[model samples]
Every structure is written in C-alpha cells, then in structure tokens.
Target: MLRADPCATILSPRTSLKEALERLDALMNRLVEADQTGAGIDPLRVAGELGQIRQLLAEAPAVVRAKDGQKHFRCEACGTISHGDRQPERCPTCGGRKFFAADIEQPFVESGAG
Candidate 1:
C-alpha cells in the first residue's frame, strides 16, 4: 500500500498561505486528538509532520516578502545582503558571483504604551 504524503496539499505551488495555515491547524488537531484518545498515530509520521511545519514556518516570512516585491539577495561567500529585483553580478562586500534570494528583516518597533 502506498502512503500518502502528509504535506502534499499544503506544498502545492497554488496553495495560499491561509490554506496552508488551515491545513497545519487540522494536523495539530489530529495530534491533539491522538494524545487525548490514546490513538496509535505513528511516531515517525508525527515527527515528520512537525519537521515540515517548522520548515514551512521558517520559510513563510521570506515567501511573504518575496510576494510583496521587496526582493533581496545574499552573497554566498560573505553573508552580505543586497536589495534589488535581481541578484548582483558580483557581491559588493566579497565580489562573489553566486547569490540566493533572501528576505529583508524589518526592524522591531515599540508601541510606547508602557
């Protein structure tokens, strides 16, 4: 019997962030159900789902920033971040040619509400 991929629905290119979040929520509900009912959910499958959730959360910010058009690039050799629509032919800091799209992290701001 072939096992269905747990992430297949959420990993699709056309899946929206909202849909992914809903799917993850459903998965979490399953985990909670198993815990409460003493169901025999496979440990390995649980671990794999958690791992995938972690990865998706980690990548979500970058994906959102890219979709918003605030594209960035990082130099593989020197860890320098450059902002632009395309990667620099050569990194300004290290003159490295290879570049990977990266996310520009926004600075934190305090609301001053005490």
Candidate 2:
C-alpha cells in the first residue's frame, strides 16, 4: 500500500505556524507507520525533514529574552562590560585583549528606594 502524504493538506491560503507544526507531527506519524510496513524509507525525504526541523528551531523565539535585557560586549579578564557596537581593543581595568559578546546584558542598576 502507498503511504499518503500528510503534508498534502498543509498547503493553504492562510497556513500558520501552528498548522505547520500539526502537519509535521502528522507526517512523522506517517513516516513511522511506513517504516513498520517493511518498505525502505526515502533518504531524500528524511533529509528534507531534518532541514525543515533545523530551520524551524532556528526561527523559534527564545524563552530567555524576557530576563536578558540586551546584548553587550564583556571583558573576559576584569569582567568589565562595554555597550559599544564592537569589543574594545583593550580592557580599561585589566588591559586584556580577550573580549566576548555576552548573550545577556546586565548593566548596573541602582536602587534608590532603600
């Protein structure tokens, strides 16, 4: 028996991300069913699926964005932070050459209520 393409129904005028997820889930089930039917799987289809999943994850929204304020460059040695567009040539505190762009920006906050 030929397996039906679950993705055939995924195409529409207003296909949302949620709909795509549902279609992908159905396709996975179909692929699993096809595997148990004693037929060799299509390598190209599997490769395409892997690529799709990678792209989906890459585009997914990050959960840590709420906590992380912004992105800034931080010094590796003295732990000094710089909000410039690029890392400084030398650290002001320790004068170190090593620097990295921190995924999270934690600027010093003063609490005046105390």
Candidate 3:
C-alpha cells in the first residue's frame, strides 16, 4: 500500500502544522473506515499510523536552525525573530539589540500592525 510522505507534504515549509495535522487526520479516518468495513487494509499498519500521528502530535515545536548550523535567535522586546549565520545585532522592528540569548519563541502567526 502507498502512504503519503509526512516529511514532504506535511512537514514541508509551505505547509502549516495545523493544515498538515488536518490532512493526516483525514487519512487516518479513511484507514479506520477501511478497517471496519473489511476493505483489505492491514489492521497492524492502521494501528502503526495512528500511533505515529499521535506521537508527532505529542512532540514539541521543532527548533529552527540556520543553513550555517547556527541556532536561531529572536528579540524578546518586540518579538522580532531572526535567522542568519550569526545572531543579529539589533531588532529590525525597534532597533533594540537585546535578544532572548538562549530562549526564544517564534509564533506561527505574527500579530499587530507593522
């Protein structure tokens, strides 16, 4: 049986986590439906996929890394996130240099007017 590639479609940069999970949920439903109706779907494979999706849902947000292997940083003052070879010297939004240094939270969606 052919299954969707989670990494390519669901985890790809162009896809949002919320959207990916919804798509996976739809697939899981189909598998379960097949299982209940005796549609020749393997029960073990169905269980495995259910477990895998559950595990992924339980995991924390993945850390973003730079192309040069540096950890990403962000400004706590104005919530300005940065990704580069090195830490940014100043926040592009407010011109404030201080950053999270070690702890930063990058939101999936940015709020407030620019």
Candidate 4:
C-alpha cells in the first residue's frame, strides 16, 4: 500500500490558517516528545515542511483567489499564476499545459486580536 501525500492533505481548500497553525503546534509537540524519548527526529523533512508551510501561509489568500474553486492556470514551466474560468491550453513561455493545482494554506502569527 502506498502512503498518502501529506502535502496533498494539507492543500485542501477547506483548510484554514487557524487550523493549520494548530496542527503545526501539534507537530512541534510531537517533535518535542520524540526528542525527549531520544527516538530521533527527522529534522530535514520537518525543516522542509516548515519552509513550505511558511510560504503557503504567506500566499494563502492569493492562492485562494487564484485557484480555489476555479480552474485557474499556473504555468509550472514559467511559474505564472493566472486566474480564469479555465486552464489555458498552453503556457506562453513553455507552451505546456500540464500543471498541478493545490489549495495552499498559509500560516502566520495572528496579532492584535483576542
């Protein structure tokens, strides 16, 4: 059996920033507990995920606006995000229509709110 992709699960459009942050907190707790028990921590994977999560949090609203419910086109070849009712048949730069759509959930520190 193949394991599911963590990023795929995390990139759900229904995911919320608040919930993402909460899950990050839980991961941190798990890391700490694992450290306490000397079970070894996967620092590289954790660091990579942290970076991706940070970027997602930073681009959350834009991601939603760009490709949440629509078939917006993002050029994997040129890294351009375009919003529309359909995916373009080709990216102007690379003329490639193959691309992946993922709902990005960004994480950020909430300030000035109780």
In model 1, where is the ten-residue run with the lowest total lDDT? 1-10
For model 2, the superposed segments whose C-alpha errors exceed 4 Å read 1-3, 6-16, 65-114
Candidate 1 lDDT tens digits, 1-114: 453445444354444444555667777777787799896577777676667666664555442255557678866665567777777899887688987776645545354787
Task: Specify the poorest-scoring 10-residue window by lDDT in model 4.
Answer: 3-12
**Overall lDDT per candidate, in order of appearance:** 0.63, 0.58, 0.57, 0.58
The reply for model 1, stretches above 4 Å from the true place, is 1-10, 62-114
Encode model 3's per-residue lDDT on 1-114: one tens digit a residue: 775533233243344344446657676677676679776665565566556565654453445454456666666555456666677888787787876643334535353659
Q: Write the per-residue lDDT of candidate 2 for residues 37-67, one digit (tens) a residue.
A: 7755676776666566556644543322224
Error of 4 at 23 (Å): 2.1
Give the Å error, residue 112, model 3. Answer: 39
Q: Is candidate 3 or candidate 4 better by lDDT?
A: 4
Error of 2 at 9 (Å): 8.7
lDDT of 4 at 34: 71
Q: Clashing residue pairs in candidate 3, if any?
A: none
Better of 1 and 4 by TM-score: 1
Q: In model 4, which residue pairs have backbone atoms overlapping below 3 Å?
A: 56-106, 57-106, 57-107
